[model samples]
Target chain A: MAVYHPDGPLILRLRAGDVDALGELYKRYKTSIYRTALAITRDQGAAEDILQESFLRLFTHAHRIRPDVPLHPWLYRVAVNLSYKWLRKQQKQQKATSDGVLEGLAASFHFLPEQWIERREAQEAIREAITQLPLGHRVVVVLFYLEELSLKEIAEILRIPEGTVKSRLHYARRFLRDTLEGRVPVGEIVYEFT
Target chain B: MSSRDLSSFDPLDRMVKEALQARFAGAEPSPRVWRRIRREAVRQGGRHRSRGIGDWAWFLLMARPTAPLVGRDEFPLGRFGLGMFLFPDAATLMTLRFGW
Candidate 1:
């Protein structure tokens, strides 16, 4: 019995100059890529852009990619790099804005309903906490938890050693645990992997 | 939060993962994103072809012989005279000078 490889045919078709193969690949992985980008960037527009850019990269580089290797890590690597670029750009813009002015603007921007405030606050807290993480730790956490990539795969995507990925993930979890100590209940938290 | 409190808590990885999943669940890229990608791909393809032509032109220019078509005497071997002291044999000197 021949095992079917979904990515194999699509990648081959893409290398053969079939644009529809690109679209097919997009349909298969867009949600996961977009969510990963959104998890890293915390911005809808930037996530959307990263998703498109990731697919575009796959399209352009299809000919050079080895068919024997899995394509998922390569795609995620591109998305992660683009997300970091977007985050760096956002940081630069934030730095350019005066702190006091930004604080005042943030204070005035609250318009959520009373009923939604708690939910929104919890969500915002998680997002803000993730954003506060150093980019290295943040990317590992996102890949491990959000994208459910194994340490080896994350290491491959990030082009780092597996030991580095493990340490980053360990530190990231510890940081988040400390940061959300009071907000998230101890019993509710679950460790997916040791 | 105290270190004891942090130590007592369950692993936060799952919670963070759940929060991310809940927040981004059902998220999809807008149609405009696909359109933009397609447009950019077309533009890049055109640019790649033009760049490829330019690369070939550059390669040909670099590959063209630098030596003049005139006699070997026209080109001074003095620039390579130091090589003669290291390799006194005529055949070896000729090979070094002509890069045969």
Candidate 2:
């Protein structure tokens, strides 16, 4: 039985040289791709660059893409590859930029100043712990938790075996738990996601 | 952290999810990204189209018969006319010479 893929038609249109179809597809997945890049790279400029490059590749390689399959996974794969390249190039400089961004984000007060400060502090710690993780483990953590992708989806996106993904996630979770155990009061840290 | 343990990490999973969401709640790419993509895509499409047209134009020029640059009576290099025999047309001769 054939599954109905919404992006199939968009892919066809794009392959037929319809720029409007590309725009529609971009609008559909831009946020997901952008967020994925941002989470992995931890740099807004690099993330934006990855997002643009990913879609441009899609446009260039439209004819080679299978229209029968969903497109987001391909976009995720491209974004991840681009993020890996960026990480390789900016390895030494990443920590300083990410920490500054985290500090800036923690300083902004959203609601009650007291509660916001404490929660932001905890979040900052968690994020710092995430950034400390090895690159492969960090990618898994971001795709699993931030992107909310399943193990299978992550495996396909990363082009690694499911066992590797599971191992990376396990180690990442343990590291985060160990790093934030005594420092953050996990029970008191309450955050609402909009 | 055992490699075989693949079950959900429970409260830790909850914390990680919430923390990530809270941290990047309003994060978004700037509108300029799409603009730049569209511009580059259009430019690339134009390049491909022009290249295709140029290739077709070259094919037609090479394929179409042309009047000889000089009549057989005026043909020079009598025995060494291999270049003229092979090219036969002024367009092909000029193309080979100037690499247009």
Candidate 3:
């Protein structure tokens, strides 16, 4: 008996140039991809563009895509590559405007005023720390935490050794721990990986 | 259990996850994204189809050998072939196709 795989049929349909299949895939993964881009770039407009370009590449390269495997990793690989490209160009052009955008992103969460006040400070500090990370470390942080992808999966997506992913994550977490320690009360910062 | 298992109930990981989730909770791309994607896809599809037709048209036009042809060296483009004529420079082609 053939095993059931959700993406197999969608990928086959996509290969046949069915835009609706692309749309279906987009509907399924848009939020995660968008959040990944948003977290990495810290720019809403650039994130949207990355999201659109990622799907468009999926559509255009459907013929080259293998239908046997899950499509999630490929989408992530493309999104991360595009985000890196944007970040490189952006670094050459302007400084990050994450303060206002991060504030807006946090504000969009409909929390009660008191809870918002309490959580907002910590969340903002955490987010700022994340944004301050080097892009390599930031990509790992986003993929690991935001997308909740496993280390093996992240290594595959980033096309890096698992040890490299672990190291980057280690570096990023330490940076965040140090940055957040004095700014916000994050309790105890443990180096579990050690 | 593997030494690489990251599921050891780490508080820092949990806090990072919560902070990320809270920051981007309910965040999504606007509807315009799909619209623009569709438009660009259609445009690219049309461009590919037209380029295919152009290639065939160039072939058919050349197959007859009705027109007098110049030497490959006399016409620098002749070395590159008529395909180069059908498609202009990359910059112009990109501008024409994508308006960028």
Predicted structure with the largest lDDT when compared to the true one: 3
Candidate 3 falls in which docking quality class? incorrect
Which ranges in model 3 have alpha carbons more than 4 Å from their true place? A1-4, A95-117, A189-191, B1-10, B46-100
True interface contacts reproduced by each model, as a fraction?
0.43, 0.38, 0.42
DockQ of each: 0.17, 0.17, 0.19
- Structural RMSD, model 2: 12.4
Compared with the true structure, what per-residue lDDT tens digits does model 2 show for residues B1-100?
2212323445566667778878765688999998899888888761222222323454543442334764565443441354344435643656689984
Indicate the TM-score of model 1: 0.67
Measured against the true structure, the TM-scores of the candidates, in listed sequence, are: 0.67, 0.68, 0.69
Error of 1 at B4 (Å): 27
Candidate 2 vs candidate 3, DockQ winner: 3
List residue ranges in candidate 2 displaced over 4 A.
A1-3, A92-117, A186-194, B1-9, B46-100
Kindly list the per-residue Cα lDDT of model 1 for residues B1-100, writing each as its tens digit: 1112233245454456667767876688888997887777767651222222323444543343356653467444533343343334643647888894
For DockQ, the strongest prediction is: 3
Cα lDDT computed for each candidate against the true fold: 0.70, 0.73, 0.75
